[model samples]
Target: MAVLPIVITGEPVLHTPAAPVTTIDDDLRSLVDDMFETMEAAPGVGLAAPQVGVGLRVFVYGWIDDDDVEHRGVAINPELWLSPLSTAPLHEMAESEGCLSVPGERYPLRRAHRVILRATDLEGEPYEVAAEGWLARIFQHEYDHLDGVLYVDRLDHTNAKTAAKAVKRAGWGTPGLSWMPGVDDLEG
Candidate 1:
């Protein structure tokens, strides 16, 4: 498996809704493998297909829970259900989020603390995961990519403006921009 170039913000694929993964062929498996590698290299808990320039409803995630349990897998054409988010004030860094597509920028945004993620596995089997805490956030973040949404897009007025400025300063306001994980000295 190889680390693929992760598309930056403003890329059409990142903004357009991804198509469902209909055929579970060897090629799709290979892409899953590469996505895992890319995610590892990106040092991110999750990575979505559109972020890697593939317009498919797929994403890979790897995270260790507070109990020392490891959760890692690929979600193909996944559907997610989330619990209501708290209206309480965000705890600065504790509630902030970042994205591989919009690298190196993070801002506070409220998200459901729990989520139910359902999707097919690599072997064409269906499965569901009940996740909470950071894992839940990861699922929501990646799922948003499939629907052509980014975390920055959900930011409030002040944060949204700041995120846009960050994107502009990073020279990522246009299309056709990408960064190769493990090669590019950057992080999300």
Candidate 2:
């Protein structure tokens, strides 16, 4: 697997919802491997298919520890299952999030503290994962990217303005950042 270039924000492909993978052929297998490679190279906890200019409902995420080092692996064609059985009600767990596509821009986003998801492996075997803490949040964030949503879209005004300035300073506009008020900074 090779590390592929990430498609920045504002790119037409990034704004469009990705297509579902109907077949688990060699090409799809190769793409999934490449996504993991790219994600590892980016040193991010997760990566999505659209970030690599592939419009597929696919993403990979893993847990990161205190040293800012990520634990590696891949999750393909992720299908989130918000458990309705928990009477405790999942609360917000805010964490600073970054993306392979957006590069250096980092912002905070609030996500569920726990989640259950059903996804297929690269081999097309069915697998179900129940994740909590950081892993759960990372999955949600990266999965959103498959649908053309960025972490910045979940930010508030103050953080959004700051993020905008960061994007402008970095010479990236909409193609590198998404603007929305009050949805992206609970954890920063």
Q: All models: lDDT?
A: 0.93, 0.70
lDDT of 1 by residue, 62-98 (tens): 9988789999999999999999999888887988989
Worst 10 residues of 1 by lDDT: 179-188
Residue 53 error for model 2, in Å? Answer: 0.6
Candidate 2: RMSD over Cα atoms?
6.7
Which ten-residue region of model 2 has the weakest summed lDDT?
179-188
Per-residue lDDT of candidate 2, residues 1-188 (tens digit): 78777766667667788888888889987887887776666666787888787888888766667778664556667788653333452333346767656666777666677887778877778888787767777778877887888888777677778877776776665554432212233113
Q: What's the residue-level lDDT of 78 in candidate 2?
A: 75
Report lDDT (Cα) of residue 183, candidate 1.
Answer: 90
